[model samples]
Target: MNSALTPDAVVAAERWTAHNYHPLPVVISEAEGAWVTDIDGNRYLDCLAGYSALNFGHRHPQLIAAAHAQLDRLTLTSRAFVHDQFAEFCHRLADLTGQDLVLPMNTGAEAVETAIKVARKWGYRVKGVKPGQAKIIVAADNFHGRTTTIVSFSTDPDAHDDYGPYTPGFQIVPYGNLSAIAEAIDQNTVAVLLEPIQGEAGVVVPPAGYLTGVSRLCSENDVLFLADEIQSGLGRTGETFAVDYEGVQPDMHILGKALGGGIVPVSAVAARRDVLGVLQPGQHGSTFGGNPLACAVGIEVIKLLEKGEYQQRSAELGQRLHAGLETLVGQGITALRGRGLWAGVDIDPAVMTGRRASEALMERGILAKDTHGATLRLAPPLVITADEIDYALDQLKAVLG
Candidate 1:
């Protein structure tokens, strides 16, 4: 190991890596559970959880143990030959989703891409739409991923800037508006892709009955309903999925983030066999998709989420967390919105901007990042305890005060 690389790692990364993300200047070295230690050995609670990837918290023993065991036995055999752990992962993930099939992918973006491909293929084959003319409807303010096809429909200029010629055949509708979704549909529209709650758009929860209304509309319109649960699923919303709040079932589910249990990059697209089965032998695949190591780790993650009462913990803790934050209303806060443990705090302009508040909180040893100008999101790991929540809130109050 290089000692020099270990010390000035942040600067070195900035010098070499692409200037893509405007990340906070924190060089995290080691982490365990819901806490992280920087290179300087200063500890801070992990509030963001890798944007909800570490729902089981950092270095969960089960996940780490699974990875270690798999590393010794096997890592990658590729899709060229079937591996032992792949079937277990696929079956467990499909059962957990109550879907008939699962297509494993290595990252959240890949899972989204898989979903897009499945929807398009199904449109042409099952729905009798022309190959080149199939259209997918996406919601406004949606954050699916950064692929060229994914970003082509993004409403964010920053995400789509200087990237063209974009993919065609996608329509946009105002989020949380069932009427807009219904109006956007045409004969060629194959699917309606959405995030039940817009996490990147500051954890915006839609109006009541919006999801069920959209589900019913899609059922009537024959448009496949795809839920981008990468950020809102796996118990982040105090339920197994944000869609559970409405008891709505989407035709296809794009899931990632916490599926790896903060141990590896594991994601999957789940749907009925008919929808996902549109892909033939050469239609879609990834080299590392469903490899042994990721499958083993992913299986452990699912087992933990299912066997343990993590979702219930998220629900109960979410109420306490939101109630605690509600007490801060009219203090330095302007607005607050969220579901489960996820929260978007709007600060008064007179007090501080979101960026400034984030910086202040960092100085006080609590790591949270800003979303929009005045909104800061708090999505701590679901494994976080009550005492930790109080401590994080105390830091928030102190910094805001």
Candidate 2:
């Protein structure tokens, strides 16, 4: 055991914070690239990457420089007044997404909520749906966010159980089933919201043609196809957006996690002008959504994506990662699913629980997260190297053995 594993720090954190999260025993104090240093002076490879928020890795130089430069000038103006960094960030992100409008927010959930609101409004105003009758169809076992309204439609008991009287107007359908989605839509249906790749449901990838089918269904039904790319976008899936893989253009994109370049909390909804333009002044706003600091960091993130180097790295390295994990199938891993640099490996439950496997990996100086029962999710920074992926796999092999 590493002598520096500070039990006292872990105990203190548990005592002080809410029990919403069950974190690993390791306490990271600093990080660089794909590695983190714990308070105990132990170094470990970071496989989670802040749930894809750190896709570019912690404290990336360009993002940090942008944040620092913005800090010296201005931070917040409350959306009451425009900041110099606002238009540029919005313009660049809009261009990058191939969308005409952007609505900035502070988190992924907020962006999702915004999308919902906009979709509903568009339904009432443009689609001629009756007021208070607009419906949006979501997926089963999907993890969008934890807000009350978002959770109301969640199939996950942990997120949905206590948080009701649930919000109405959302219909749940079996994910990756285009037939179910097609059957669910009605005259009142305003949108079909889904994750291109379900992240929290163990990085599940839909069958080929699923995304395109959803797009077609939405188009035929005159319903908005809203892709929540919060976890799978911004180079995490070896592309600007996972829906890009199918050459499908959704009506709206809910983006976050990596848009701030792992430096600040920045999120947004990108859509066509006619769709997002439905939001007039005072209809929606955020104090810190498009603040100078967030815009500064976001602009740099957009610039990085525009270069397309990170997306390229994710595509190439992701192949290496999946190939390596395939070798472990039936060894300890029972199933594997993911795209780009993200993966979900299902360990043989007879051998160990997912939590136990995560703990074992921690002991080996590697960090990963488990979901469901025996499924472990690995989403390393796009900046991680091939050698580092091999090292993490080596650690996994030992842990399973």
Candidate 3:
């Protein structure tokens, strides 16, 4: 940055640039592994991990090296013509996902959009649904993306209010209730899309066997099951995908965030050829979807995940973290819910709300964010060490005390 570009300097730029996000007060300057340094030079443990985009941690060396090397070679060649990087990325990502094909996109929202189109196409061709009559089932309180088409199905007032003439053909059902989902499906229903764990819904984990039940219901009913793993995938939840916890696989997987290894905007939809191949050449595409830089970083991300220790680390650390927080349940908390390294602790409203606890944690040098009104989410990077967890827990205890 320039000499004039302090934390305040960057904040000033954002004030005039866009008002879209309500970011935390801390202005991060540099990051490595599971920690970030502020412009003022104070370091804090990053528990949010860019809302799970930094699952491999901030500025991971391998991901960074891949980006640097790819930058030296090539960046964007677009998808209009094939670059050497696109094919390998498609192959590796498809192989990793255990899917027959992969459709690349640049952000999580676009992947959702792509999946929506793919589902509709499959409905038209395979399921034999009439054009313009296909319906998709989404859960209430879902947070897929902010795109107009995606938000039209949202049950949240804040997400849908004033965004009108909304797209139709979406059905809403209660989350985690398999019967609700099963009942909501009709002949027009093409697919059931839901998060394996509602990460943005305060890390709400469904009842046991809900995923397996959902998969079975979808299979028996002949409706496609789409999983939005953008926030909960890539070992963030102690599995390659959160669905792995129950060994439940969806028809289509929407992935983003950490797929770029926190280095670029890389996202995609992974599915069997019969499902994802719904998109013909002229149907849909993005300029930077399978660019070389993103592909390189993504390849490195897979390598890191395949190294096979990070997921195990997250599972073990999550147990320790959950156990530590369980000890705080009667102290001042209402409840706790989550899986792996992702947790949402509900502070007793009588003592504190999520906002207040977030502010307290920030002041104590452990950064986490609040969700809803009373739940604080703690989703540290999967690579965080035991000492880091101990430090963060100490900060939490100090703040809560």
Which one wins on lDDT?
A: 2
lDDT of 3 by residue, 22-134 (tens): 66677778899998887777778899998889999998888899899999999988887788788888888888889999988999999999999999999999999988999
Cα displacement (angstroms), candidate 1, residue 266, comes to 0.9
lDDT of 2 by residue, 324-361 (tens): 99999999999999999999999999889899999999
**Which one is best on TM-score?**
2
In model 2, residue pairs whose N, Cα or C atoms come closer than 3 Å (at least 3 residues apart or on different chains), thus clashing, are none
Candidate 2 wrong stretches, greater than 4 Å: 3-5
Between candidates 2 and 3, name the one with more favorable TM-score. Answer: 2
lDDT of each: 0.90, 0.94, 0.88
Rank by TM-score (best first): 2, 1, 3
Error of 1 at 247 (Å): 0.9
**Candidate 3 positional error at 327, Å:** 0.6
